[model samples]
Target: MATSNSRSCLKYLLHLAHDNLDFRLPEITALLALRGKPFHPCENFREKAPFWCLNDLSEEDVHSIMTRSICAKSAFELWGHGQTHSELKASLLNYPPENMSPFTHKDSTYRINVYTFNKTLEFADRIKRIDALEYLSFEGTVSLKSPQHIFCLLEDYGTDPNNIPEQPNYIYFGRWIADGQRELIRSHSVKNRHFIGNTSMDAGLSFIMANHAKVKENDIVFDPFVGTGSLLVACSHFGAYVCGTDIDYNTIHGKGRSSRKNQTWRGPDENIRANLRQYGTEKMYLDVMVSDASKPVWREAALFDAIITDPPYGIRESTRRTGSNKDITRPPEESHIPVSQAYHLSDIFADLLNFSAHHLVMGGRLVYWLPIYRPEYCDEMVPHHPCLRLISNCEQTLSSHTSRRLITMEKIRGPEEVDRLAHLADLRFSPYQGHNAFREKYFSGLNKREGEDV
Candidate 1:
């Protein structure tokens, strides 16, 4: 029998959700990085595959990841895996008995669960599959209701639902460790939230943004274009002190017409602070104010641990900033009353990146969404800053011709480290200038689609 001390040599398997295929790897990598561990995949690793075998991670590391991951469904300590049943049996036979004995001991209670990916199996077939594992030594009593340990036999039928293989492409057996925080999506759903807006982020994606920002206990998070504080609510749940700034006074105060159906006006307590109170994280609320993100109000210093925001793309909401026309002259004293001007999409991103570079602490992150016109989108279209390093770009398609990329960047150096203006000389930054016309192009696409239909 393999001793418990040898467990560190075992490989772990992460059963990731099939959805959010593009975001899974970055989410997992960020979670692993939170623990100061690098992502180490085993041989034949597939990024889009449902199951991933990770090496050089301990049981504790797996537990930490599962506690925060929304991409992964479950994780397990891999005992053995193979391409076929015969190969699986041979692999299991080769597994050290010393390690298996602790769980399969005479006085232990255990249960085996059968799981198939992209395919369903009948109860009889599931039983037959479990029965095939008889080759392994098991002295434990079978406990269906309550077991001291749970084991799983997972079969991967490949990713394509239209082309599922007749037999599993691979098989794996392992002891279940922990399940991921996928349930947070349902439990924190915006449908039941106290405060919401037309642009309020979905609960699952909000949590994913927080994770990508590496938000943890005692960290400070800020959202510049916080519509209804949806991002703040997610960060507060993770023990981060949350604050935000919105240009709309009505939104910051939550005193305008209600976004809810059948409601004409917002109630007295319909606000971001109340939203935090609803989630039992009111203590993490710092404050929310009506401030222009284009002209940051924070002092000249590293202020926040992370800045996670969703700037308006002029789709559901019109993107505007507090300003008058450059040629217009302001009258005395009346200048206090702010006027509005269209905030071009290109300038929005440029300002956001520049603001994050100044306000975020060293090694802190900035995670935000960048709307894209699929036909004109390219890697260079992403905005860059000298102090920040681009981390990941994951796309979420909104339509046949439109999508949004979640861009994550980390501040590697301070403003003094490099000439911030140097990048402006490069033509790469000019690619995003096309984004200034995004709104016009967006409506044009809709009109073109309508024409095609006619």
Candidate 2:
């Protein structure tokens, strides 16, 4: 009986996927932020819990979220919930009959399903659970194959799989509204991709980064250290115009050795634009250039709407830039390539923060990965700039002692706000004071796992 405009009082239950626990809240929060809405979680809020109850959201809002969310599996209209079956019956009975009337009408066809988290149930047990919901008046006829209205009985047996409780810690009854975009993970997998490399990002995380960047239709996105254009492929899927720059000419031009096994050389079409074309978003491909990220080739202007990338941390790809020890007074010949030098992880982040602050439009975002030496990673080590505000920091652990944090920041003030003595001019470039400091720390963690002396 709730009108579309009056549905804010209705609560929605989100069934989030079990993986990527750290990224879920930020992804949902960012998606909600896209609609000019704040994340309003309800009682029994646990960061790692599979089910989350959110308040003050309309059904339309839920659909919009599910359309873009890779973290969530499905969403429901929370009709009633309780800690026990008897309590759940009481809660369901207490729900206004007017709200139930529309879906439970005699002329409507409906089906009831039972879902349990952290536990598997026999078919009989699932059927028994569904039959228990007979306490609620259902005037509709049962239609298992195709139902006009679908309802669910969800039970939470707690998160401990090794110690699942005999009874669910909680119970919920709701109308199934929509499912999330989780299929994108498998469909856009790197294994099936046309263009790939030694370090192409996984599909699910690419979508998550695009979601965190809050990329939308017509938005212009840029990647500073794009490898195989995985991030650009993700951004273009969201209708954003995508471009990038990488120091490696072979990578940018899709030449040289192929990343795929048994293939000695890359195909002529194995390029970033082709990757976007593989996903049917080729029209959104702007272009990628073989330019150094440290020395940005763009004119002095705020052109990008969102900048999303994953810089090399020396695990698979070496981080180098166009540079030299001795300064040359004259420019080299047009075809001559400059000698390369080490691009320290510390300076990488420093340059990234500064570049993002000046290049991103106001309210635009800069989403990138910062490798962490887990033991030494304090929040202070996240580089800062006057014009950018840290938004969300989520971790994706690679090893026992090594991980990378996905840091999302937004342009709060214009580039003009950056002033000498007010911002980072006096601050340390990063906690990684020297090139060896970062490189050694990163490799030492890996060495520790291999039983080698650091």
Candidate 3:
């Protein structure tokens, strides 16, 4: 008979979806750190400390990875990680433990994005595993289930199999990464309200919020520049209450702001409304207000457990005005008239850091994305603050229209602790550092004695 301790030694199967090859090094590192394991980018999975069976887009490759994996999980909507399409196709073809008999103790967990389900279900059905499919979490559209349709599929159409397990022991709603959660937050509309100049949140914000959701619950989440309340919407969806503030009144009313005519233009703009209607919540109350993110008027709400926002990088209307009437620059076409001086891009970061320090609760995570104007500025800006400590520089990315630097910091006190953290941040931002070392150190601590099982 197998020993109780030995039986509990789980074989975790990890289905690594492809992330953009550009800026996901930090994101990859953060996942390993959170799991308290070391991650190696190469193909040898059998002997690794975490024993992750990673494969990209191909079903054949996924079958191969699962055949070798003991306990498996799936992650979806991975974009641009593989170098070629052939490589991606090879990855997915490797799933469902290829040609093996389904066993009673077969471990199962599935993670997917909302949009990928139509494709994912086809793959999930192929896995002939005999035991429970315990965990189910998604980052895609939650409204797709259409309860009636799901009932029909399960009961009448006989879609879901009889042998499959009933309910998951633990389930999470949102993306596998924090950045996915942030995007959902950014896309949200405040009671069907639109925004004047609010655009989408960078990819990393979505990753960070998803990670934060695992640890924080029943906490008030704050997004000062709520703009249509994307971040607030994500937090609310994840079972957390949210409070948001934006200066654009039109954003709170769903009416297009006069300055930002493109947001509410009735022509192509019908897409946003259509998508919301798809979720059956185009008229949902967002609980957001028209207030500046720099200065929030939070009411009876408790201190925020976390703060995640994409502060304008001077690419939007925020850049149009600065201190006085001096003109900064005009579009080449508008040489006839000059506009107000745009704010120095550097000042925006300075203000964002200061504003976050005031609102975020101690020990609460603050994940924000910034366009890198000057890398050296991060150095000068970091150590000056006493209340905030730059925890991790989750690498950098060239996001749409801007090269972004993702900085994850925590609110804390004590000058000495913050000082030490500054040195750590410096190492993290340095090329070829932080990620591997952090994972190595953490995994070693978790696995101090060899042969002593987890």
Per-residue error for 189 in candidate 1, Å, reads: 0.6
Predicted candidate 2 versus true structure: per-residue lDDT over 241-328, tens digit per residue = 9999998888999999998999999999999989999999999999988888888678889999999999988778988988888888
Candidates 2 and 3, the one with greater lDDT: 2
User: Can you tell me which runs of candidate 1 are displaced by over 4 Å?
Assistant: 1-8, 326-337, 417-420
Name the lDDT of candidate 1: 0.91
TM-score of 2: 0.95
Please provide TM-scores, in order, for all candidate models, with all chains considered together. Answer: 0.96, 0.95, 0.47
The prediction achieving the highest lDDT against the true structure is 1
Winner by lDDT between candidate 3 and candidate 1:
1
User: Which portions of model 2 miss their true places by more than 4 Å?
Assistant: 1-3, 6-8, 329-336, 417-436, 452-454
The order of the candidates by TM-score, greatest first, is: 1, 2, 3
For residue 190, give model 2's deviation from the true position in Å: 0.3
- Residue-wise lDDT of candidate 1 within 1-454, one digit each (tens)? 4444465468899999988888999999999999999999999999999999999888888999999999999999899999999999898898877668889999999999999999999999999999989988989999999998999999999988999899999999999999999999998999999988888999999999999999999999999999899999999998999999998888999988999999999999999999999989999999998899888688988999999999998888888998777766645366433788999888888888888888999999999999889999999999888889999999999877788999999999888645456457757778988887777778888889999999
On TM-score, the candidate that comes out on top is 1
Q: Candidate 3: TM-score? A: 0.47
Off by over 4 Å in 3: 1-9, 21-198, 202-208, 212-215, 257-286, 296-302, 320-343, 373-384, 399-402, 414-454
- Which pairs in model 1 have colliding backbones? 1-97, 1-98, 2-98, 2-99
